[model samples]
Target chain A: MQSIGKRAAMLGVFSGGAILLGYVESLIPVLFFVPGMKLGLANLAVVLALYYFGPGDAAVIQLVRISVVGFLFGNLFSIAFSLAGGFFSLAVMCLAKRYGRFTVYGVSTAGGVSHNIAQICVAAVLVENVKIVYYLPVLLLSGLATGLLIGLAGDETMRRLGAPPKFYDAVSNQ
Target chain B: MKHRERRLNRWDMALVILVLAAALAGFLLELTWTGQGASLQITVDGEVFGTYQLDKDQTIDIGGGNRCRIEDGAAWMEWADCPDQLCVRHTHISRANETVVCLPNRVTLTVLGGEDGEVDTIVS
Candidate 1:
């Protein structure tokens, strides 16, 4: 298992992985949901943050990634959507971290679910009609599934490294 | 580490199934909710020409030069003195805020959907 510092470095690595995932997902062409939405693998960094560094760091990392990705490959409209999803998911994960044990998987799951809901809400607000709310039930469904998988991945990653909260020490400034 | 966790709780399974169902429902709603607030407003040479109601049939006189029957919310030039007969080829505008411009006769068709008129403009 990589130390937290290396894991932090992995943030950049995961981001590269995520960028590749994003482009690949887009290329598949056929969409299960609205044409605009995607799996957002870049969130792996956010998942890593909550588990290794703490929720605050996780939130900051997510914000930075969202901003950079928006500027690099997105338009103004997409940026707004990213803000809602990324911020909401991070906040949810942060809160979950307080109540739940330091399980990286669970935190990541919470973040994933919250991210999709916020994005859907933003879309509804932008269209100036709640009629778009019909998309909510589906969004929730997708969120739940994706969240679980993301959370599980984080949890397994930690377990395999034979590390717990102590793993975070690698990146701990103290 | 990401490739390993294949086991998921029952809740996880339910969540995925539920979301897939909801997505299908939303797609169906989109298919049916094609209602719009306005239709084709065609103009020619600064003259008050005609209007078209979508999903229905009608006709318009384009400044006495072209006469077209309005079929399916579009004005096709049934008869035109203009060359190329492009005005007659105008397709119906089902989407909101879309315009089919006919430059040869200086006629334009614009489709306005939803309550754009009542709602204040925010941003494009």
Candidate 2:
């Protein structure tokens, strides 16, 4: 078993990496025509944490990343939106991973789609107009594409880093 | 061992197909719901500013360094000084309920149709 200090260090590293990735994502030019679409690069850290350290650690990293990024680069509304999306996405991804029937790609894709759906729901409430739902189709497609890309990256990174934790093996074998 | 674990399985393909089908269905549903609107309604900070006939070609300066244009029965954000310019980049909207929103400027332009009364009932 890892020592307490070692586990804490791992958490800190994941959180820090997630925050850095969030900042990098903000630097990319907005994908015009789709107001909220993004590559979601920061999710890589969360995905890694989920697979290696489990859902609890992944949730911690996600929350830290969203709060820090929102405060630094966005307003209250953006923060609320991020919190909603982050929580919903993390929940769905956790469930998908726990089911053991899906690979990383499937889990991440589900996360991406849930994130967008949560944000759109928030937008509808704030704007007091359901017409915003019209953006759903395009947002869904973008989510699928970006999620697949993140999943591919996450899988390759884990492979190169060496054998996954024993838990991952057990999950996969099941 | 890891390579086999990373490979896409049938479940993954099924999930992707399901999401794609959902998107396509949503697109078709939206197409059926939208129709040519009669007027353009402008709102700022949650207050209704004014309504202009879509048939009338005109430019509306929404102050706060944002402008909207209506022509050929369609309305669009003509210009915006907001740093992101997301609203300005949006495509022209001619169908009922379509909108161009400038979050930074707190301005929204929505297309309204004579038949919108029915849509509002459904939404509410």
Say which candidate scores most in lDDT: 2
Q: What digit string (tens of lDDT, one per residue) describes model 2 on residues B3-107?
A: 544378888899999999999999899788778798888877667677888888888888657889989998999899876788988989998878777766667
List model 1 lDDT by residue over A22-132, tens digit each.
555445543452412456666765776666666666666666666666676665656677888888888877876786553555566667767887876665455333444
CA lDDT for candidate 1: 0.59
Mark the regions of model 1 whose C-alpha exceeds 4 Å error after superposition: A1-30, A33-36, A101-105, A169-174, B1-124
DockQ, in order, for the candidates? 0.10, 0.49
Off by over 4 Å in 2: A166-174, B1-6, B44-49, B61-66, B79-83, B104-106, B117-124
Candidate 2 residue pairs in backbone clash: none
> Which window of 10 residues has the lowest lDDT sum in candidate 1 chain B?
B115-124
lDDT of every model, 2 decimals: 0.59, 0.83
The first chain of model 1 has a TM-score of: 0.78
DockQ of 2: 0.49
Q: Best DockQ goes to which candidate?
A: 2
